[model samples]
Target: MASLFAFLRVISLLKAVWTAYSAFYLFRNYLAARKIGLPIRIIPISHTNPFWMLVDRHFISFIRQLPFGHNSFTRYNYRGWELADRYFSHHELGDAFIVVTPGRNWLYIANPDTIVEVFRRRTDFPRCLELTEILNVFGPNMSTVDGLQWKKQRKMTATCFNEQNNEIVWSETLGLANDMINYWSSKALLKTVAHDTRTLSLHVLSKAGFGKSFKFEGHDERKESSPSTSYKDSLQTILENCVLIMALGTKFLENPWLPQGLRRLNEACNAFQKYMTDLYEEEKQAFAEGRTSGRNLMSSLVRASQDEAKTGVGLTENEIYGNMFVFNFAGHDTTAHTFTFALYFLAANPQAQDWIYEELCQVLGDRQPDEWNYGVEFPRLKRCLSIMLETVRLYTPVPVAKWTDTRTQSLNVGAKTVVLPPDTMVIPSYASVQTDPKYWGSETLTWSPSRWIKTSNSTTANLEDEELITPQHGTFIGWSEGSRDCPGRKFSQVEFVGTMAVLFRDWKVDPVTQSGETIETARERVLRLIKSDSAPVLLLQMLHPERAPLVWKRR
Candidate 1:
């Protein structure tokens, strides 16, 4: 029996290796065969700096014809942020058009109408592809759950984030903001080191999303505010590693012989799974006994998964955890990145930041913490909100969004017919739409909040029959377009607004370093790279020079 089992393992191992190589070769062939339309134009990007150089240029050629079609590339200003843009955008075949990922099972698309249709069908457009590891590693959590399951999970997950629930959540956001802003005001260090906004925001999400209080929020004896060991850092590392191992899954799964790294990763997944299971059980028990209102997000999910009200389809505890992890990555990283990038632009344009601060004080005027929630406080808040929204529009958190259509349906895109069968990779040109001269106006590239306020200077374009999707345009599809977009949108927006209000109400910021650096990172759901080691940091308390540099005094 033992010998037979060993022999079976050997066969499995060889098959996995073969499949991996076959997948790689298939992708290479696709790349070779692909070509761009001649009249459109193509820029040959050197394989070496192709990604970063393009991102450094923000991908929208400032000078269209010169550096574009010539085997060269354009990128974002931040070098680290460019990699994702490269994987997501391509114009002419090899130039800046589509990327034929490995397995040949997916295609990276940037066409405007093609992406719109992909988003239109929530059932068909799944966030995951066969090559994506987020779904496999995390399981059917809210983030990866699709079809009816996603819809159900999204509903259960949303109860905690609605405007009605804002009061409940404000307790946490306001508290954290106070700590963060005040601490910055008191810091002695003129310089500080922290991960880009992605990581910093993760800390905020932990407190807001899962309902944990921040360890580094207020007047601290603590100096460094980064995630400390076992729980925070380890979890982030495991998630990032999940992305890595998934990329190498074919080789690792082959040979039935478990590699040490794979084995270790598996163990971590199991442990993480177990942790989630325990929490679910606890929440379920509390709700059952009527000891808790099931107010936080986890409790809501547990209740729904166990609800007799939910017939036919329901979620498992493990699945909810998987979703929570996705929520963590999406909510945490996207929000944080937006905050960081917004700060970068705001700092670069201090006049806008100052305007925003002045607006806040005008409406807020010695008001108590909860006063901003009422109807009277809206106008000033709206202006501040518009600035943040505009910042995201200018430098979106994610450059590319990729999905696969699982339905045997067709959608019309201009003159072309798109047949989306199961696993058809679809990509959206997010950076283009946000920065399009036609829709947002030629001055769209300029980082100005006044444009979003709908002034005479506010311009509109005829991209589609409907008004271009702006903040005023109902929902910002940057979270995604259509029903299939991120369910966590409302949740993330609230977290962002709450945190920003708290911090900015107390400080002023400007770019003193890493101002022109480009963002670079490996292509995936979330970004992890910073443009440079000297990347810009939001200076604290400009009001009192002697206090903390991270926090400035209110003028």
Candidate 2:
């Protein structure tokens, strides 16, 4: 006991000394950065400092998540686009208490033209740091690779999202959705408790992406029961474990040097890698047995791996690992939020939901199945879909899109040129542009999907929400710009539509209480979505945030 006590004392002393040193170093760096005219704001707290350390660390992490949902409304996009505006306009939103990592470091680009230039110059700004690192956890999937690696993987992987591939995925996706609808009908008295949009998306991703059938049909004799979780569930457990902890910036939540937290994190990562690696090898064996593809994302990934084997330069396990990371967070979050928010807009404008139903009836019969072939029906529903896109713009799932400076030369920001030392980080402000009075007209802040209707009731035809913003225009960039933009956008679109179409066709979302406060999506400079809590395991293909604060009535 004495020896153990003594060791703890020694460790405590060491941590304190290191923290003091870090504090000194951080301050020195901040001062030097300030002297060089960088936007470096040093925090007064240190990692070893008392409560402030937790505040500083979590606040920073949460700040990054602030551009959307609760955080954005709470903290001003958590200093996101406004941060750039402040950097540009010399306005300080924060006290000295909130510090940036020095220098107008990385890249400070806010103009539409420059946004085009950055996306166009592929090598100049490729592989966003956070995106790439997170992708690494997917075990060498196309999402993690750059250059030839991405290209090769993109080829076979692309097939998985093709119309036919999507048809297969969506069929299963709708099956899950139908099941959920039935379940909700059975348990109408649940009062919609114990549900959220995120879980819905996770369930859909599990089925559509991993091919795990989770019976959403509650106690229905005709419907299969929700299956016990399989490997995909196990894998997801690890994935969620890693993202939640890592995204929160662990040292902030717990002791930085706590072996317990670190070890838990490390274990999650290792377990995930092992699981994915083993699955990949098993797939390789299956391919050798002439099994090219199965029903889910794993099958598609395995097929890609098989193709990669012939090239001898196939995607590394890292790429596979990274993409899993991408799908779990990016794949699920954005689509789920879109699905959820679209429901909010539709409910707010039930006329539009009825409008959507009218279109669905015209395009697809009441009994029409959920398949990619029916994707053609989505265009008729585009007006409603456009409203959904607007929701994404007004409430970006991600607050900022970032890239590390690969430029050897100074990036000229019109009048003032900021020379970005190689490997600096620069995050573009999509949140600002989406809500900016400049591009979106004066009332950009309000939720008005009617703005997307060009002819209104003039009886017009259109395709799925003709992208309001493109990589070319830099308008609303929820999926980001550049070659590194989410390759899964199409996949997300399909999932989102599948989820939305079925819900509107069968149900009416009425407010439970007229006086209930409608929660606005928050936005910090960075964005994190805190979805509504009322959504059930309605396993439509995407996360359905609309589940919150509403009662689903049978139409």
Candidate 3:
């Protein structure tokens, strides 16, 4: 009885000590932040905690709904930047503001010049390697590695995204878009546009990355519930179940006693590995015989690996597979989500569609999609490019995440010198900066695709020829900025442009109207639905795109 009472006393004493220590720790950080003269918001929990993240996220959201709280507090997720704009719309956060949470400090930057400085000084402000560790599930790939390993991976993969690969993307995308358009046209009312776009992206990535092709169809369209282990089935399964793979890992799923879903995942991963291994062997044999064409990304990576093998700097088998998976993951979903957003934007605004169709008519003339060469035809379709650029600007698929140097770093925020602590996360809010009126005029919040294009003659009905405006440095970072920017920028551009030309050239799309809603009202409702319903999934996408069915008609 005495020992039990003593143990209870110890537990109570420990809890009291912990509470005091936590309070003192937070108070110390508060004083430190005050000394630096920066705006500070102290939260009790770490943003990374799943439960606390959910709670605080909802707390901020709740605050945002209360009176002017909507204009005061930033929400905690991807759309957090919406309220971030309200907070820093006038540069109230100046170059950066400090967000102090338990055991972590986040410095969110809204200033373009400071963002450029952060990007330029890579050594001073390197990538948050810890944040990307999830991407290293298979092995150390380009997205997750840093320093020498990342350099080697990047050099090997860089050659794969050249002009030749882009040409392949352009041609393949045209074919896929044509097939997808046919599929959509067959639908009584086109729902599942998001799923359809994802299918199209996966097909394009397959052909462009691995030189594999497939007919466009719904994800669940296979007649057999359990298809044989083929490249299409295996790759699709892997892509769709990435979160599961990330959580449970390849090893965990190997257990014989696991659930059917996990067993399926294991089978899919094994099948994908087999497919990749065969591809690697084929490429190796071709390289040995000096017959390598380097047509697709995989072939290019394989060629690079062979060349590096002589110098003892080649990617290992695991590294190669990791990179290939990363490429598929990074390339597939992001571009697909971008496509969905751009499509919705175009459908909502018929004027934008008209502009795109006009440019397509002028650029392609009477030439069919097959005849439309990447080199000749792609350069002429600037409006299509503008639509993509505009969409990406507003709905950036991936936000930039960097951290302060190991040593304290000084930043010039307006006229003040702010010293950021070592290892503090530095997020350049792309949504806030890209939409800021200082760089993008007063109508920055509006989805006006024309903002990206400059007309030669404002009054001329011939809007066929217009120059795409290049935003000032650091102001436009949809594909990100500096050395670590996305390598597949051109790949995505080629695919997006090709898909747009193919789909919108001969047809018009509008939201399906309900009982008494006119086309214009439906369009307005769609615009609202996208604004309200769109949130980040794997990427920023229409949360429930099926809620708004689109109708297609020949123009």
TM agreement with the true structure for every prediction:
0.67, 0.69, 0.91
- The residue-by-residue lDDT of candidate 1 on 105-222, one tens digit each, is 3343444555666676656566653333434455666545466776777766665465544444555555656656655556543232233344445555555455554455332343
Candidate 2 lDDT over 1-555, as tens digits, reads 999999999999998997787667666646544543444434334322335433542465565664552342233222232422322222232111123332223334455665666676666666654444444444556544556766777765665565654665466556666666656655433333123344556666776666665555232233321112245445444544654554544344344465664555544555555666777787778888886555666667767766767867655666665665566666765665566556555655567677667656655665656433545654455654666677776556654334545555444443545544454555555545555665667676566666655542335454333333232377667667766566676667666666666766767665444234342331210012222222112111223332344557788
lDDT of 2: 0.53
On TM-score, the stronger of 1 and 2 is: 2
**TM-score, cand. 2:** 0.69
In candidate 2, position 547 carries an lDDT of 37
lDDT of each: 0.50, 0.53, 0.81
lDDT of 1: 0.50
Off by over 4 Å in 3: 1-25, 54-90, 224-228, 456-465
In angstroms, give how far residue 374 of model 1 lies from its true place: 7.0
Model 3, residue 35: distance off in Å is 3.5
Model 3 / residue 532 / CA error / Å: 1.7
Candidate numbers sorted by TM-score from highest down:
3, 2, 1
Segments of candidate 1 deviating more than 4 angstroms: 1-114, 123-125, 135-138, 188-204, 217-275, 308-310, 368-380, 399-410, 415-424, 455-476, 513-553
What's model 3's overall lDDT?
0.81
